[model samples]
Target: MTVDSGIQWRVGDALEPITLPPVTRLELIQYAGASGDFNPIHTIDAEAEKAGLPGVIAHGMLTMAKISRLFSPYLKYGWVRDFYTRFVGKVFVDDVIMIGASVAEKEEKGAETVYWFEVIAQNRKEEHVAVGELTFLV
Candidate 1:
């Protein structure tokens, strides 16, 4: 959803949540090819199992990209100045991720207003797989 840039934002405001579809092996392969991240753990189940993982897992950067989609609306409106995240857990194939964010702080920087959001990426079990902060100039 697009957050209106003209609206007054506060420190406790909640950004809308974004629910992503399940990560599939085919998609992982595609991401691997496109991103040049040909890690067997993200594609070959045998390799992942040998590495002590349950099965083929998704790339951490892929999870970060999925979570970043939540900020696209703001980016499209030129409200986002910068964004980042840290991977805290592994995401496996068939796992569904949900991205959420909340306004942590807001302040005026010169003539611009800056908004800080605490972003989180969680799996179906509500376990956080990634977390970080985003800065936006609005």
Candidate 2:
């Protein structure tokens, strides 16, 4: 909570969790148009079946974007330097996403402080869909 100070970051502090509503085809379609990533597997059911998916699956980046929301409240105190993720599971239609991050480490870099966070996204079943590291420079 004390982000403006020179140094008082707790290495194991947990950010608030954000739970997003279930994924829907409409949202996926919209994301496709907006991102110009009209990948059929993310929208068309038939295409998803053709691609060996149970149904239209959510775009991996879409889930990544959800993970980024965990940093919104901290943006004013720092800028995101890097975000890395590994897609461990597929996101399907109607799957609710829960994103969370915990402070993994903190350090002072002369004038700026750096924070490393362990970020993760899980489905309603508590299965990990994404795991990653986030670097913030303050």
Candidate 3:
């Protein structure tokens, strides 16, 4: 459904995609500091190399957070009831990610509407780095 003052929110409808700033090593370090997940693989090249990684990779939660940005515009209409993410690919420094969401199904219970959404985060190569389901109430 299309709201007069908002974007479409309906089953099988996709929200506009959002591209985020490129991932950088410094940003990784900042994320580690903020999230308190100071794993060296996300901030130290030597540690990542020792772990058989191409280089320091971005944190999975960071990627998940980036994916959530796709829902920012819709929050005014309702609120997210639940969100789950599965990390599929490594996100390296300099990689740009694009995120989007599509409504999968909806249910009406009493005075509330529940929406199930499919969310995705893809890298510059268009590979899915994170994908998830989100529940929203309107």
Give the number of the best model, judged by lDDT: 2
Model 3 clash pairs? none
How far residue 115's Cα lies from its native spot in candidate 2, in Å, is: 0.4
Better of 2 and 3 by TM-score: 2
lDDT of 1: 0.85
Q: How many clashing pairs per prediction, in order?
A: 0, 0, 0
On residues 25-75, what C-alpha lDDT tens digit does candidate 2 reach at each position? 999999999899998999999999999988999889999988998888777
- Candidate 2 differs from the real structure by a C-alpha RMSD in angstroms, to one decimal, of 2.8
TM-score of each: 0.88, 0.93, 0.90
Give the number of the best model, judged by TM-score: 2
User: Per-residue lDDT for 48-135 in model 1, tens only?
Assistant: 9999999998898888777667777766444666778888888988888999989999998787788889999999999999998888
Off by over 4 Å in 1: 1-7
Which regions in candidate 3 have their CA more than 4 angstroms from the true location?
1-8
lDDT for 60 in candidate 3 is 98
> What's the lDDT for all of these models?
0.85, 0.90, 0.88
Task: Please rank every candidate by TM-score, starting with the best.
Answer: 2, 3, 1
Model 3 agreement with the true structure over 1-138: per-residue lDDT tens digits: 775664446789887888888888889988898999999999999999999998899999999987777777778888888999999998999999999888999888997788899999999889999999998888
Candidate 3's TM-score: 0.90
Kindly report which residue stretches of model 2 are placed more than 4 angstroms away from their true locations once superposed. 1-8
